[model samples]
Target: MKIERIEEYDERFEKDIIDQHGAYVINDETYAFQVLDRDTCRVTFSNRNDLNEAIEEYRFFGGHISCFVDQNGKILKEYDKVSFFDMKLEDIYVSQFYVSEEKIKRLLPYVKEFLIPVAKIDGKMVSLDGHTRMKIAQLKGISHVNCYYEEAGDYAKDFMEEAQQRGIFHVYDMPLLSKEEYEEKWHRFCDDFFEQRKAL
Candidate 1:
């Protein structure tokens, strides 16, 4: 739950990764996957409905959450930095949706337990979850936050291994986006997604 807010981006690393491998990079030393752009969220959940569902279940594993208070009595939340790119955005048409900002604002006063997910690595705290809550806190100008640390483990490796054992290949693994496809499709997908959310 305790995470450092990013003050800037390493444009150099981002450029290098995009130019060299068509991937986006996070400067692990100082950056976080804090940008919650629709594209990035789509990439994270892309073609991974099972994982998205798993995340939803995992989110409530514990009924209680811890909060941190700054000297000014402000509540803080946890946020993490992550990487994003085109390959990551493929087949993301059916991922889970995000919590509405209005909902968060409305529930803030009644929230008794606020969860901020983090990984503890050799005494250093790193964010593993709760981007939406953190963004809400930032918008509210509440700078105090806290979290419970989970031991560092190879979650991605373990998840993928289990997936491979079960013969699960996400849709994104199949093919690269043709330039025409990206131009004609991705934007429309985003537009449709927002419209649907608005209707909801």
Candidate 2:
């Protein structure tokens, strides 16, 4: 339900192993969850389909998620900051039209974990943040990416509606722009939108 720890990247030190708590593992490595219960169970994910079941278990695990570990205690992926599960890229809708090419390139190297943020809005999965990172993963031909749900406020619906009107339904519809153009366009648009809201 929340993030409490990010397992070290390939450290596997003797002091790091939580030998008693339940964790979600891929190839027998612990990726998430290290709670108070020593009797907690470990879930292995050999198939991507098992992710959903593991998520459900995480919701009820009675502890925060500890994402980062492989079956052999090697770190497979590290988000460093967020607790997220795997989600198909196609299921997430995007709100931005332009992603900075430079930013995308900088983030591409960190695509191994669920770093992009998404949220369920009106029963649909909407990209809450990290559009550039999501775009990078999509361009990398990655089918599944790591994502965490974000809690949105009342202003979110307005943002989604505006993006919808602009024909930005998915990440594919977004175009990568140079940093200068991205700032001039996207930043200007956000400023204008916020100003309009202030007037209201």
Candidate 3:
């Protein structure tokens, strides 16, 4: 993924109805807009400088912006309280890794194929580290679900710890592997994981 330095926040109005609000702002924006049918509002700033400035403003103001939007896309006078912890799947980055075809064939029958639970960080939605599961979810028209706000560094460490604890050293943290190595090993692990699951 392309990492750009953020500088300001750009605010724009949406023409959608707020159906169910999520727990937190998915990104570093003041308003976290969640609309009906699982659609979300994306804020586009002119540049990274402006984006960073906006983020800083939001952080200074208590790390959140809460408001209620009506069906006509109007923000109601009453402010809704939202926490930073209530992040969505869209906010996180997807690691570049390949899912094995064998795993897909094996898990296809047993897995629920909807809203695959990825990783969670302190109870908030984070990244879709599982490439195979994400692809499957998309193919099936299922929402990719996860918890929020985990630093990439911290996530790398946690992933390593979990793998080591579970004796899954073969599937090491993505950061530790070279891009090519990650692709090969991830595919192998995906196949083996589903194969074991099927055996049970």
Candidate 4:
């Protein structure tokens, strides 16, 4: 959809989520959102046991909650991170601004989720937001991610351009891996992580 402002995008996101998972309240002064697909995600309320239990049930029943589940059927609490190489960063935003090292350092401690906003660019999924989050993830060397994406509507390009002009968005012309390549990389990364864990 065409998002003129961040608030508008957030509103649309909340509405779409509520439509799918019903309504819920946030707890712990934090919001936990689960990505459903390319266009929808739901927020998991914090203190509301009913809502949390419902989500746990959905996740237990093979729902795509985008978080890790242990063998005991419990969600592992960790910061949501994604591989920088798995993301598409070309022609999605406008500016090519540099990320501040200090900003990344400060945000790393409290990063519960790296909320990547993705949209279609020439039939390929490209990042529409979350440059800072992605950079932080890359720096921290983590896998798995908590991200959200929406399919671009007719006015997507115009909206992106407008946002870029307003300094609200930036674009990257980074090289993207093919699907096969990405899969190979993902497996390699996982293997490396496990190997390192074993060594430790």
Candidate 5:
């Protein structure tokens, strides 16, 4: 099935989401929306066709993204979050040293966008965020995740350089630490860097 993203919205569709409550009468039976930062208001499919034994309940909340199908189409109950990797493991660098087992377990069950970018200082790609997800991906034996280049801040170069100095060149290089160990080691190091920056 092809997913066509609606780039433009009509008046009623805009009013239904923006005006707090525009009633479901304005929808086209397959329209669904999840407003960001507005939990109370939800615009869903207007066509209530054959609910008897076909479908019982629809989730009131959506994931990070919103999906709406076309006429004769239906909402997808779940989505496959793809992690398309291009660069090899050797091409990527890790910014952090330790990963918390607790945090990894907590996040592994959820859908996440695994993004990486090139470091401005050294011209090498490093993970600014989603370090845990990267590690998890590595543990799962998947090579080459997604890359969103040039999105790193200036401090990212420093973090990557520090990780490089510590021999952490890839996600697999970083070791798993207990929550306490992670806080004491990784968090302290990050905190110290920010504090030094503040002093400067």
Candidate 6:
């Protein structure tokens, strides 16, 4: 899908989000929760009430909401929450972006004998997203990796470009796929591996 690029500092979308307060209706019933700034976009919220219950969750989890963009670059009616779940050891794939020579040296030994819960993303998974836990898993040989199934759409490219422009190294690119393609591949992978699954 093609998407028009909006220049940095464009206030239109930001204004729209803010005008709607903390929640913007994407479609008839689907809504995207808005946080005031970038820092608050990374937190995981188990429920909508979680946003009001704590400042940290509001700041981190409510920050950036995901929405589909049409070819015209207008935000579409459907959107998704960014989330992940623990997967068994064998189903996870090590990201090419995060795989460095030193990381390899450190990670391989643990991979040999245990299941480690690393974050897997089919789209641009930010460095700040789960960098700490991944490092700890690498060093400690922890079991169960958190896998983020890439949500297919053009939004990830924009997010990645913005991230790069801001000098965020932890956010890295993944192969783009449409939403249907992503779901198909994920189901195929799950069936092939016979692994237990949960959605975050």
TM-score pick, better of 5 and 6? 5
> Which candidate gets the maximum lDDT versus the true structure?
2
Instruction: Put down candidate 1 lDDT per residue, 1-93, tens digits, no spaces.
Output: 222222223453343222212222222222112122221211122223243232223223221222222234443332243222221112111
Assess each prediction's global lDDT (C-alpha) against the native: 0.34, 0.59, 0.38, 0.44, 0.55, 0.35
- Name the candidate that leads on TM-score: 2
Those runs of model 3 whose alpha carbons end farther than 4 Å from true positions after fitting are 1-90, 113-125, 144-200
In candidate 4 the C-alpha lDDT for residue 28 amounts to: 23
Enumerate clash totals for all models, in the order shown: 7, 5, 21, 2, 2, 10
Output the lDDT of residue 2, model 3. 27
Q: For model 1, what is the C-alpha lDDT against the true structure?
A: 0.34
Ranking of all predicted structures according to lDDT, beginning with the best and ending with the worst = 2, 5, 4, 3, 6, 1
My TM-score estimates for the predictions, one after another, are: 0.27, 0.57, 0.28, 0.33, 0.55, 0.24
Question: Total backbone clashes of model 5?
Answer: 2
Candidate 6, residue 16: how far the Cα is off, in Å: 29
Tens digit per residue, CA lDDT, model 5, 92-177: 78777778886676557543444444443566667666677678778887776766444466787788878879988788888999
Model 6's alpha-carbon lDDT is 0.35
Of 3 and 6, the candidate ahead on lDDT is 3
Q: What is the total number of backbone clashes in candidate 1?
A: 7
lDDT of 2 by residue, 1-200 (tens): 33233222334322223322234554443344332222232333445544554555454322224343444555433223445588888888876778888766554543444456667888888877767767877787777877776676566677777788988888887888998898899889989988988999
Better of 3 and 6 by TM-score: 3
Q: Tell me model 4's lDDT, rounded to 2 decimals.
A: 0.44
Cα shift from native, residue 130, model 5 (Å): 1.4
Instruction: Between candidates 4 and 6, name the one with more favorable lDDT.
Output: 4
